[model samples]
Target: MRTTLDFTPLFRSSIGFDRMLNALEAASRVETIDNWPQYDIAKFGEDDYRITMAVAGFSQNELTITQEQNMLMVSGQKAGEDEGQYLHRGIAERVFRRRFELADHVKVVGASLVDGLLTIDLKRELPEEMKPRRIEIATGEKLPRAGTKQIETGKQAA
Candidate 1:
């Protein structure tokens, strides 16, 4: 069964969340998206994540990883044609492209391919200005005296 969601209500009340809502809506609309080359997303730490993809018949030269803004794209295309005739072929030998939407502050640190598995590491590095900070509050008794004299001006009044 297929279902459609109405985001009109959410758009009316929410502010500055258009990107998030659009991503959610796009994900929901693509019900029959391809699931080839199985993948796994795991979190090792609070802000560290890894994406592992099973690319059995693909090589490092045939795969490409790109990052644009907040989107990460991984694509693979087999090079050259099969030389020998196969009686029973089970492995998938086709081109595929996968996209991942990353949140703000999340960046692709590194990627490695070993034994048919492609692992991409991600880290969320928040800026110093955006990190949590403590604000100091002054007590009532520590307030400046209202009767304090103002600094005298160097110029003489006419």
Candidate 2:
């Protein structure tokens, strides 16, 4: 049984969170999709992440990895190979496409395929402007403008 959630109320009160809400909706809808070619997401460091997928019998040439906006797509299609004759085949040789939603500032650094496992590396690189900064606070009273004559408060001239 599939249940649909209503986010109208949540959306009405939230601001600048449209992407997060959309991602939640998309995640809820992906339950019915095929789960072939299992994968794993692991975080090594504070800003470093890695995604590994099991892609047995898939060559590097037959696989493609693409990034569009905040979406990362990994697809693989095995080329038809002749095995002479098989009485009973159990291994799956099907095409698969997997997508991962990346957060803002997260970028794909590199990818490698070894021993039938495809590992994709990701790093979060925050812009200099967005990074934490220190603001200097004024300690003393405000200074007077330059080239301006200060009037004596105690004695006033007529």
Candidate 3:
């Protein structure tokens, strides 16, 4: 059972939140959920993150990781392998594609495959203009007192 959500009201009042609202709407209407190649997302530090995917038989050459604007995609396709004779096979050898929506400043750092696990590292690097900055307060500066004026001592003709 899938129910669609109406984001028209949010779009009408929001200016730069269109992508976020669209993501929410798309998540709500997801009917087909694929569980192949299970993955886990973990946060290490304040701006560091890692995604680990279980890929039992996939080699590094057969996998691909792509990153676009605010989006990350990981796909794996099994290479052709010869099977002599198999009475019963429990391992899965199918193609899988996984996508993850990234934040504004999130970037993929590196990736590694070890012990049948594919790990992808990500780090959120905010631009220098967007990072927090301290405003310096000037010292040794005095405000001029109002209604204080020096009278000029000049000769006035009567």
Candidate 4:
């Protein structure tokens, strides 16, 4: 049985997290029956990741990868039906589309298809300003004080 999740309460209590909540809601709506052309996501390093999809009968021209904003979409469609009838069809050849939500600063570096496996590589390249930085603290004596220690009359009589 499939269960639904309501995000109304979270919507009211959260700020700037609409996209995350929306992704959760979208995931819940995915149908289990539509799972085909299985894929795997693996992380090799802190900022390096890969996605491998099984596409036995699909050619490079039949598949397309697109990236828009923070979303990565991979889709494939059969060019033509098989000419001869198969005694027992074991491979999946239907059209399929898969979407992956990417985090900020994450980028798709390369993709390759080998031995029926479609491998896509990703890397996280944070911009200079967005990367972690250290703040220098001023010591008590090192910090230059503003104004004089005590105030005195503007001028003295001749």
Candidate 5:
């Protein structure tokens, strides 16, 4: 069976959700993504992420990493040489652009170029107010949680 989630109540309770919905709708419209210099995204912890891109042939001076709004963009372009006679040019020295989406509270730690790959590390430091807390349960008291239902099918409520 398929069930639909009703976000109407949440939308009504929130103060500024229309802009968020519009932003999400705009993000959904993004169908084409620039893929260059094969990359890998690895999760380190509950909020840590690392993005490593296989950036061969490009030097440290050519690679550029920037953050705008909520997106992390990386681009590279090699400088052309004027004193090169190419009789059999096979290597590609083209420019490439890559983008990575960042989650809320995530910040770019920095980037490093080692060997032939460029690695960019990101970390999400959740505030104390946002992180889950371990609450001690009382002997006969019940706790209420958000996004969850407490169903008493056969057990009696104390």
Candidate 6:
């Protein structure tokens, strides 16, 4: 048995869509980054989003949130204890980095910590120029007369 791979037709048909082809190529190479400290991404509305990360035992000062380019990076590092003797240390204070891809015009509003949960709010507002608008078609262009097409068949115009 032999396996033959054929992509000439697909490639030839998508010549005019270099950007889309590149996007598909890029998407194929997307690697699964590690999932650190669990988090949640929620959509509140058409232009609202919220990201909540499980940051127990992490103080607000230990967490840093920054937005660079089109990526939202959240990092955590706990303060070191100098004069503490731990017999059985189970809680992990190791630093972790989590990244999220942000859409165009999306921005981080602010972050707050409550009940050991860190909440990060993000919002995306569409520009006025990008919003959809209703256009009223002129009365003449509404529709061709019902009998107009029948004229070609020698039928009397009603």
Candidate achieving the largest TM-score:
3
Candidate 4: misplaced stretches above 4 Å?
Answer: 1-3, 140-158
Report the candidate with higher TM-score, 2 versus 5. 2
Candidate 5 stretches with Cα past 4 Å from truth are 1-34, 133-158
Q: Model 4: which ten-residue window has the lowest total lDDT?
A: 142-151
Evaluate all candidate structures by whole-model CA lDDT and list the values in order: 0.94, 0.91, 0.93, 0.92, 0.80, 0.81
Query: What's the TM-score of each model vs. the native?
Result: 0.83, 0.83, 0.84, 0.78, 0.63, 0.66
Ten-residue stretch with the least lDDT total in model 1: 139-148
Error of 5 at 4 (Å): 19
Candidate 6 lDDT, 22-140, residue by residue in tens: 54565556477667688999999788999999888899899999998668999999887648889987876779988887877889998999987889999997798998999877875
Question: How much lDDT does candidate 3 score?
Answer: 0.93
**What are the per-residue Cα lDDT tens digits for candidate 3 across 27-63?**
8886688988899999998999999999998999999
lDDT of 1 by residue, 1-158 (tens): 76889898999999999999998899789466699889999999899999999999899999999999899999999999899999999999899999999999999999999999999999999999999999989877676668978799898889
Off by over 4 Å in 3: 139-158
Residue 102 C-alpha lDDT in model 2: 96
Between candidates 3 and 6, the one scoring higher on TM-score is 3
lDDT of 1 at 147: 94
Best by lDDT: 1
Give the residue spans of candidate 6 off by over 4 A.
Answer: 1-33, 136-158
Error of 3 at 89 (Å): 1.2
Query: Positional deviation of 7 in candidate 1, in angstroms?
Result: 1.0
Which 10-residue window in model 6 sums to the lowest lDDT?
1-10
lDDT of 2: 0.91
Which residue pairs does candidate 2 place in steric collision? Answer: none
